[model samples]
Target: MPRPHGFSYEIRNDTSVHITHQGRAAATLRAGRAAAFLAEVENGDAQLVMARWTGSYKFGNERTARNHPRNRR
Candidate 1:
């Protein structure tokens, strides 16, 4: 069997690509990095939220990608 609905890429302006799966935020890729994200997704090297700490992908509407896995203050 295969995934019913896999990743979906939405180009937000000229330098961004927002990736979504089943309506979740998933990942937001910037510039040419979109291709790299796609390649990862394609090659099964990463999942929707795989780049959990990558500055390259801005996840969620609140831009929580950077602060994720928050460090103790």
Candidate 2:
């Protein structure tokens, strides 16, 4: 699968995390979630981490599902 891109995050002064994808707001994490996300992001791919946090990460089955016999239009 291709690596996820276009994901960025900002830490607000109030300790909230604002996550964006392709320049649009995708998720806002506050308090406990924000703390956890910061910890994980520091240890892994930031883009992938953001994508996963926003529930937007691909699971590697998209192409197969798209071309499956039953999916043909």
- Candidate 2: tens digits of C-alpha lDDT, residues 38-60: 99999999988999999988889
Give the lowest summed-lDDT range of ten residues in model 1. Answer: 52-61
On TM-score, the leading prediction is 2
Residue 29 lDDT (model 1): 75
Each prediction's RMSD to truth: 9.6, 1.1
The segments of candidate 1 whose C-alpha lies over 4 angstroms from its true place after superposition are 1-4, 35-73
- In candidate 1, which residue pairs clash? none
lDDT of 1 by residue, 3-71 (tens): 224445666767677766657776677866776665666667444334432323432444354466673
> What is the overall TM-score of model 2 with all chains considered together?
0.89
Runs in model 2 lying further than 4 Å from the true structure:
none
